[model samples]
Target: MERSTGVQAYYAESAERLGEVYESVSFEDVHGALLDLLPEAPARVLDVGAGTGRDATALAGRGYTVDAVEPVAELRRVAERLHPGSGVTWRPGALPEIPGVRGPYDVVLLSAVWMHLPPEERPGAMRRLAGLLAPGGLLLITLRRGEPPVDRRMFDIPPEEVADQGAAAGLRLLRTVAEGADRLGRDAVRWHAVVLQLG
Candidate 1:
């Protein structure tokens, strides 16, 4: 997939800043709405666009095997160094065409990544993600809402759009929560999170 230079630079040039933001985020906070849907311990997890590996590291600490796919080189380097031996295998990959990452994961997570794709790309992306799920697997995605920042590439993606895409992908909607604030305390930013169960 061809990535926008702005999106590339936003992550690469601002790795340090993004690292600090990701460092403060917790898996519990982000996955609270979908906890009940997640499988039991020792479940295989795939965290796509896993920034800084914070959530992957946390889940790995609790005995889950995690495959964290981070496409950014600098962030992957920092994440590996920051959370080594956490039972999390960090792979370099991205969405819509998640190359180099195998799936059938018990849980698939996409934190703050859904909005990065253009509206038309969502259905195919969701289909690809759904195909990666194990039976009864859960797919959790958080869509960033509100106006996009000047530094990065994003759309003010709506939760309904995501649900529609998921439905087209043959995923059953489990939950939809639209009240999360920015973990970095960005007032201009908020989140729309969704949980889907694959057939």
Candidate 2:
């Protein structure tokens, strides 16, 4: 986690700013690509790397049981305050090794957070996430593809490669949405969503 300092710092400092931006957007705007694939309301959802609890809280509001994992205390604090008593359980955890969170979830969402993992950890992270899915569960991942901010750290994660990782993890790809610009209209950014099922 030595290399994670920059990422941790970025989120810690910009949580408020990011929360404001996220507040102005709907969960559908961020995850509409998998609208049809998501399990019914009241299903168990694990929102890994859930920042500011926006998506998790929204899903909870719609009747889903959500566990939102965010390792950054700065963001977690703000998220807790922002969505107080929203029925979302926020945990302190990170990828490749998210601790203290039980799984077997109907839907496992990793939105816009996949690119943060170093390239070498993708396989293990995918495997770990796959292990958490219930039978026929959907693993929804959004990969950001493009150059990172000059100050922030990110990789141009390849969609095809992520698909391969899913296959390697014994998951089957269900649907792949077309690429789109960042929800915040960041020109240098593009995102692709892939829904994979654990049979």
lDDT of each: 0.82, 0.87
User: Per-residue lDDT tens digits of candidate 1, residues 1-199?
Assistant: 1155678667877777878877886878766766677677989999888888888898888788999988788888888888877878988877788877777899998988888887667777888999999888889888888888776778888888788888888888889987668767889988888888888
Question: How many collisions between residues are there in candidate 1?
Answer: 0
Specify the highest-TM-score model's number.
Answer: 2
- RMSD per prediction, one decimal? 1.6, 1.6
Cα deviation at 23, candidate 1, in Å, is 0.8
Give stretches of model 1 more than 4 Å off: none
* TM-score per candidate, chains pooled: 0.94, 0.95
Clashing residue pairs in all predictions, respectively, total 0, 0
lDDT of 2: 0.87
- Predicted candidate 2 versus true structure: per-residue lDDT over 1-199, tens digit per residue: 1138889898889999988988888898888767877778879999988888889999999899999999888889989999999999988889887867778999999988888888888899899999999999999988887777778778777778888999999999898886687888889888899889999
Q: How does model 2 score by TM-score?
A: 0.95
